[model samples]
Target: MRWLDADEERAWRALRRMMIAIQSRTAHDLAAAGLSEPDYEVLSTLSERPGHASTLGEQAAKMGWSRSRLSRHATRMEARGLVRREPDPDDGRGCYLVLTEHGLRTLEDAAPAHLESVRRHVIDRLSSADLSALERIARKLEEPT
Candidate 1:
């Protein structure tokens, strides 16, 4: 395959740098909320549901995570009183994940700060045209090959 031209290479490098920068800043913001990146991710995933609960496989799928990874994280969160695991009544072999009261409260408190961080460090830096370009790029990337 043909390699990128100098300008394309520069653009690619800059995009990579931006991604790393945004991820680091977001992780730091979550850490300040007394949650690690993975913790926040799992909690956030559950929070999006109607009752803050989902099956282990559903959570894994939503986060593009492995079942083992979700299981390990769930175990730690359960020990910390942030979440609880129970057998799915509909399917004895399946497990259901529920966010505990503490998890809900923590996530609610963290949402504002996290949103502001994203706005300031990412969205605010972009113009409307830039945002449109970003959306187009993301859509293209998400499309099936």
Candidate 2:
């Protein structure tokens, strides 16, 4: 197998560093709001849905989290009045996770600052061409083998 050249290796390392740093910083920010990255993702996912609700399995898939992890986080959120869990009407054995009013409000309030942090740390640092290239690369990497 061919190895990356110096430039490619540098770029790959940089990308990895950025990914780790960004996640760390974002997690810290969310923690300040009494939310973890997974917790934030759960609310963010439901907020985008038609009724701020989704099935537990769907939420797990979207968050790339295990069922047990999602369930525990959902349970914590429920205790905090950020989310509600109920039996899926369509399937008695299934569960639905819904964002509560407080969840929506918290996300709405945090979004602007969150976006600004993203911009300051990630988006603003990239040129338009760089962003397009990154998007193209990401699409290729995300494709099913």
Best by TM-score: 1
Top lDDT model: 1
Alpha carbon lDDT at 128, candidate 1? 97
Candidate 1 C-alpha error for residue 97, in Å: 0.9
Per-candidate TM-scores read 0.88, 0.85
Give per-residue lDDT, candidate 2, residue 87: 92
Instruction: List, residue by residue over 12-79, the lDDT tens digit for candidate 2.
Output: 99989988999888777767777777777888999988789999998898877888899988999899
lDDT of 1 by residue, 1-145 (tens): 9999999999999989988999999888878888887888888889888789999999999988899999998999999999999899999899999999999898889889888888988899999999999999988977779
Candidate 1: lDDT over CA atoms?
A: 0.90
* Total clashes for model 2: 0
Candidate 2 is scored at a TM of: 0.85
